[model samples]
Target: MNWDDMRFLLAVAQAGSLKAAARSLGVDKTTVSRRLRALEAALGRQVVEVRGQGLNLTDFGRRLHRHAEVMRDEMQAVDALAGADTGGALGTVRLTAVPMVINQILVPALDDLRATAPGLRLELIAEARDLSLLRGEADIALRLARPTEGGQSVLARKLGDLDYAAYAVHGAAGEMPWIGYETRMSYLPQAAAIARSAAAEGATDISVNDAETLYRLVCAGHGKTLLPRIVGAAEPRLVELPYRHGALPKRELWLMLRRELRELERVRLVAQWIERTLAVRTSQAQPTRPPDHRDNGADP
Candidate 1:
């Protein structure tokens, strides 16, 4: 008689018992009995019978069950069609970021972005290698460290400070392992601080460059590295190093895009998604000092 009656009849005809039907419909047995009685009363048909063994579906009940199945399929089709017109934006937006942020921050917040833009697609480049926006590398770049010199200028937004604190794998800080940078780079601000700290603390040096590799080296219980507290805290094994004297220097991370495409839809979506997703991490990275994350928190 109605959509609900059809659904109840369908459940009952398939389950064959009031108790079983009630469980399938997620309602009480009494409710199922009441609805069934009402359906039969309104239709003037013997839809069910109580036997010595249990309940049985009458001929009319079987007929209703077949139609109910068709009805369910029709309802599903209607729902799908109605939902087709809903959603905000669409299209693939390519984005690039350092590995630490990708692992610790961005990866976790993607589901929320999906909810915001159901048809939105994201392509993430997680390597440390600088991808060129002018050369078609990425629609948006999440800058943890300074951009590699000589790419192309773009519209940049300072996400926030990437707060750095001297950290080690638990007790490894006592034995300072200064993570150094790649060869051919000049003295960076953080490396300079670390060198001064090592000198001040009278500790030996352990050099490393790549941020991802440095994190791995620290995780293996090797030594301490000046890393973004927000990113490093995500790894369960690593612990903040005991500060020798003062607070470690902090570096502000920037979100950059192609200078020409600053207003493009794809770039805008990607940038908005990145800022919204990493806002908390950026906020956590308060500017306590100077820019030191030249290579995403790796020593200089």
Candidate 2:
């Protein structure tokens, strides 16, 4: 008998009723009934019997069910193999990363990524919180720190380091108001670092939850705030403060993926692109000398 007929038999055997089987299979009950009859006719034996209140599989039907399950598994394996072979590096890969990295770093490299793998599509989930890779919420992740809870099944690599520098609007100088992360965000390493640095410099008059918001306020001449060097360097209106006393702490950036997904061509390609992009960006980020305070309209 054909696999389609065997599928109906397996469904009916598992569901115990033609109506339930049809519902599960997305077909009419009559269709399932007909298929089962056709399969029995071809096999020349009764595979099922009507019990007191439900359908029961006969001895032969139970044996056939075992074989059908094996066939179904093989079919699934074949489908997966065929899809992978035909769609090499062509499907959408979901990536989750913090907003700053997406906007300041990854977005700049999109053109190169497209050129390298035109068939690959990207779905970016920009949020600070780590998305679940094991649950398939994301195919890849760029995290500031190695994830603590995704288990050993996750594969992570240290892509590069992100350096932070205190920035302010051009000409804004000494003892200026500082912007910092709110207490709610103090749990983050970057926030803690900013808090310590700001404490020694000036009073924090503004507190925000995200780096992008802090960046905007600093650029608007609101207050000096610590930001990733890459972001601060891109803003012409902003100038980096001298960290002569002590350099801001550097955080390591990580590229992570589920171990199972590493085999996919698209996943591997995207991971390589991310690693390369971050490395290049990090290398190109030159340390800028603290702007001459005298030029700006600030008290000497």
Candidate 3:
């Protein structure tokens, strides 16, 4: 039997009378009666009997009502799933970033993100290695370098530069040893710059792959190491070295995402939050140069 007719049958069976069923279905009693008769004719069976004050369902009608109930439940389940899939600002957004940035920048600003987007959940992947946005590994990514190869599907935007400086423990003096990245990370621009400076001064003493470990080593008076200005500035014991020691190349931070996700309301909100938060933090950490300063015919 047609599902529409079955629906009318179920409604009439539950409501007991055509008038009540019509009230529930928002239709007139005569329309309900006509539809119920059509359902009975389609099944070729007398499914209802006219009782003194209401309609009573026959055994076949009761059986059909049970099947219709099951179909209604299944349809409701499908609609619920569809609604969840289309929900705009409610769901998990996976974000990936380097460990240092996650620890120094994203972690401190998470409360702001949660306050602004209470319906959005965050799944953070903190690692130095880049995760694949094209493979659906992450929804948003914060990287030190702009991606060179994700094709048109990838959207990359420069947020700001991560400035670095040599940090030494408070009250340390004399020719200090230097800490740097291990051989595995020597290809990093910061590492290469530190290595050259250390070699010229004969100051290399230790190497480590992780930025936190390097920071800790420097704090213990092991040696000075290049650290992100934001991290170094927060530590009371660490003092920034003068620029004359040679400047390390500042790494540009880029926000990367899949092009399709750029328009998703939740993702877009998170992206804007990250951009604003990092911009504020970076400005606070770096020293502002005078507008009048010019270097080699270029603005400094």
Candidate 4:
């Protein structure tokens, strides 16, 4: 197989389509397609298969993809070393996390990052879905729970714990309706708890996927929902519900990154900035006690 064709394979594997690969490689679609065909002919095996508008890797292609990633990382390491000699971390670091963490936490503290590493550029992706680190979709990811994927090629570390609390409109009286995550998010303990409470009360639950939307609906006096204390503390109009803090749901914040990128000066700088920022934020929101506290009506 032509070593040069490996770049085409790696590009398509990461982008999931030939057109995207062509765009990344600064070539036309025909060039990418021809290169892929030549690669397949050389190996006498297919690397990728068409699936609707996208392409999926074959078993043989997947093996090649892994090798391609190692090559990419090694090249990046060399570039990083060369760049490091210039005296400051330079280049972009893509970070992914849920919207609440992005909007409520990190976005507010971006000035700190600029001051620490003015040459560093951060691309923040705010979504619930995990982007592939090995595929170079994101350089670092913040997860609410421990990540199950990535094996040895990824590094996982605990940043801090996020405490949850029930929030509703200030001075609001009576049992407000329950606002919660959609059914698809029931894996979240707080979401499941809200589902149970709403179901038992026979109250029609309002469901939303994003934390910012959920917080807005709750603040509008439409319903009560669980929010990370760090998020809830920002709004004075949204008051914490009567539920005991100890009984509320809490989740650990985890940082994940590709092991290959760990040594890059820019990647390491951004990772440390994230760690420091979250540590300060979590400490500000940590609850004082762990004793018995009863939920008045909002269980979560």
Best by lDDT: 4
Q: Of the candidates numbered 2 and 3, which has the greater lDDT value?
A: 2
A best-first ranking of the candidates according to their TM-score comes to 4, 2, 3, 1
* Residues 1-300, model 4: lDDT tens digits: 788898899889768999988987789999999999999999999999999989888999999888887786676556545545465548778899988889888998899888988788789999877776755678799999998856666899988778887777765524576788888889888887777766754344468877778877887889877889888767777766655323678898999997877877778888988988877887776554422223344332
The top-ranked prediction according to TM-score is 4
| Cα displacement (Å) at residue 70, model 4 | 2.2
Better of 2 and 3 by TM-score: 2
What local lDDT score does residue 221 receive in model 1, on the 0 to 100 scale?
71
lDDT of 3 by residue, 252-280 (tens): 88999877666566788889889888877
TM-score per prediction, in order, is 0.55, 0.67, 0.64, 0.73
Please report, in order, the local distance difference test score of every candidate based on alpha carbons: 0.66, 0.77, 0.75, 0.79
The CA lDDT at 104 in model 1 is 68
Candidate 2: stretches off by over 4 Å? 1-89, 173-175, 291-300
Question: Which stretches in model 1 have alpha-carbon errors above 4 Å?
Answer: 1-89, 144-153, 199-206, 245-247, 259-266, 283-300
Rank by lDDT (best first)? 4, 2, 3, 1
